[model samples]
Target: MASEELINARHAATAGLIACASAFVYLLARGYQARRTFYRLRQQGMPMPPWNFVLGHLLAVPPIMKTLPEDTQQPDAFEALCRANEKRDADSIIYLDMWPFADPMMVICSPVLAVQACQEHDLPKPPILHAFFNPLAGGANLFTMNGPEWKRSRALFNSGFSASHILEQTSHIVDEAEVYAKILRQHARKGEIFSLDDVTCWYMMDVIGAVTLDSRLHSQQQFNPLASALRRQIRWHVLDNEWNLLIRWNPARPFVQWYNSYQMNSYIAQELDKRYAEWTEDEAATSSRSIIHLALAGYMAQQKDKPRPRMLDAAFRDWATVQIRLFLFAGHDSTSSTICYCFYLLQSHPEAMAKLRAENDVVFGTDITETAKMMREQPHLLNRLPYTTAVIKESLRLFPPASAMRGGQPGIYLQDDKGNRYPTEGTNMWILHSAVQRNPKYWPSAMEFIPERWLAEPGDPLYPVKGGWRPFEHGPRNCLGQTLAMHDVKITLVLTAREFDIKHAYDEWDRLHPTSKVKSVNGERAYQMQSGGAHPADGYPCRISLRKH
Candidate 1:
């Protein structure tokens, strides 16, 4: 009996080893097949650069990354890589074969191809988006969801961002901008250099809370748990230009993620519950027209013939909280980065600055002090400041924060104007916003800070191409808070553009920075970095002083 049992055990062990060997062989076969397929396609006239059969683009990416500074963002590197490989006149969409480290990516380098991917095909967001955001959002939110579920969620959340609703909520944005302006004033008085990015982030958060949830976080004035946690969580989300062992191997990161999620989730839930109760109680006389309130109303309206719950249901609360957090994260991050860049660009070019101030003076009245008050009373007047709006447009053209990251599908192939088609199967699709937006073929004087491009008539060379200016992106999956974001940036510009001049203190920042002597990338001190979002390096360390009118 013992001999029979030993023989059976040996057979089982042999079977297990064979299974493992077979799996390894299968993976090797897949790798070899991927290499042959992509290389052969490229040789047959695909615009993609050659790659190593064994290492894929794993070895390729780091060498290109080495061109820019250590802190230069992946988006920035994407442009550099594309520029190195792309034919100036050819219809180009560069494909990088990143394996094991990241998913294989087919980057859309031209606005025409971008339109094909985003509009024509309307591809779903990549699974990596969900993988990256799952921890941050608690689960898949608007930015990550795809297909039928995505469509349903998108429909439910649409009413909250209607122009009418956003108009109702512009005052909240102005209110928060006033607090931000006051904080800037205090910074100005101190005559000290500080992080415009950090402070701007706080202000955006406050605005998000007020406009979205009808709550006063007062993050600018004091320490807020939600704000702190959000920062930590967001920082944790940034992929290092290197191997990123700081995050990958840190055992404490899981606890940190849990704690931060708990804090943000708890705060969002508590605030949402208050609004939920308010909606339940009144229904008709709903005093607040915040984004979060409208979203909740939208979700509730979708309940066909279901009995209304006295309290918030689990599914309702969970889904609602995730959307609210999405608003909080997306609203604050990209908008804040734009605000910093607006300051950085305006200070860099005084001609544009003069025109901006002149426009503001004409629109907001000569007394810059009253711009905030004027904006709050008549928020629609911001729409009237075409040049001011144009400056924000131009700033976004130069420094778009993020884009809709779509996954490559089996049958989808992006076709350019030249009739060139590229296969996108089994890969992640990314439209390099900087490359597409600033491509000289699309935008004349693309590298220059030209606000007039947005203002020029259709026949003119400087006029924006139809699909070129995609800072907030285009198509159905475009940014929901884009209108709000435009208004928020305009309001901040109105409040601060004339009152204070914030200039980059990069040289001083580098001198003062204890650990980082690393300053500037390709002579751009204010280059954007991929830290949670495309943000100015070192929070755009700068000195602020009162502008002499």
Candidate 2:
């Protein structure tokens, strides 16, 4: 009986050894396959970064993440990488094997190539972004969908952004600008160092709420819950690298998605429910004049035509959430960033500020309300404000709100005007606007904040210089809210310039905290402004006094 037991034990040990050996062989095979794929891509003349056997370019990922101070550095790093690659005349393809994926990830820099990859429909949505945004948002929003779905959703949203609609929104934007002016006047009287970033973000939030939801919100007011929540959500989505890691790992993604849905989507739904209920109870009896009302009316009309669409109630609610969220996100951060940078540049170049104020004085005389009215009455005045437009344009070029990326799939090709074909298959390509905007090749004296570059004559060789522009990006995938953004910027500048002569309180640019998404001049997350809204922590501290002009 002892001998029979020993034989059984020996057999079990042998089986265990065999299973361990098989597992080792499988891992080794995968490693070899990944290496082989990397080399195959290189041989096909594809641009790629160096990779480790198992982790592709992940070792570099952490460094890239670390280089930026969560608020400004990520965007800056992306721009820096793009500039470095452009200098090398190398295609913008960074190899990333952070995942157990088939090929190295590619980042695209060239505008023509980015347009081809994004608009030609040759590339698939980046898997991480797709899974994170689409599933969480219910696959109905423009940012999440691809191919036919994206096309349809885009069609619906595009109708509301037609030229006429943009023009019509200008009056509303100017109204908000008056509010900003009043706030700045009050702050200036108190002589406080205020955070323009926070104030501007709130300003934008209120604007989006009014325009999209038809709800008036005092976003700039201290202790506003909705505004605070919106700010928190923005900070997380734009600045959090841990979230990025979770999304990269497939197994952990569902949990991350659930967390995001719980935090963002559900919260938004609750807010909407409360607002909708209030509207039904109090405002339904009166004529509604907000964009939300218009959208709801349009939606109802469409639903009446087709009674049995898929998840009609859920879709409408989700659609409203998307519209509001998109506007809130886009409006708040983009506008705030623009305002911060504009102030920075203006302060750095006092001559530019002087010129801007001079122009403001000529356009509006002495009254803030008159200035607002003139801005609306002569929209062309904005287009014609050579130096003001130049400064705004230059700032946007340096610190774009959105970074553009392209995904790789089979049969995808991007050919430049020079006939340089860059493979877009099975790779990711990103156009860092900061990099493109600041390239010395594209803009001579790239590091200098010179608004004059944009004031050159249309046909002049220096006009926009090659590869130097595109703050709003070029082609179909560019910012959909460009018009609205421009309007907001114009209104804010006009109002702020009218009330105060803004100057940098901090000596250097380093005073601001730079993050991946928003650029803050000061290390603090919020700035105390002497006038107007609180500046973002990543923005420079600028002092403003009543304008002597």
RMSD (CA, Å), each prediction: 3.1, 7.0
TM-score of each: 0.92, 0.76
Off by over 4 Å in 2: 1-35, 59-72, 78-103, 119-124, 131-140, 222-225, 238-291, 305-312, 373-386, 416-420, 465-468, 507-539
Q: Rate the local accuracy (lDDT) of all candidates.
A: 0.81, 0.60
Q: In model 2, how large is the Cα lDDT of residue 34?
A: 62
For candidate 1, write residues 1-549 as lDDT tens digits.
Answer: 999999999999999999999999988887777677667666867666657778766766767765676777777777777777876556757887766556677877788888878888888887787766777778879888878888887776677678877777777787788889889989999989888999999999898878777778899999998888887898776463556676567888788888999999898888778877877788874655576767676767766479887777778788877877878888898899999999999999999999999998888899876777777788778888888888999999888897657878887887777667788887788888877888877778888998987788879999888888888888888888898898888888888888888888988977776553445665678888887788998888888998887
> What shift in Å separates residue 518 of candidate 1 from its native position after superposition?
6.3
**Residue 87 lDDT (model 2):** 23
Model 1 spans with C-alpha error above 4 angstroms: 1-30, 238-242, 285-287, 302-304, 514-518
The true-structure Cα RMSD of candidate 1 reads: 3.1
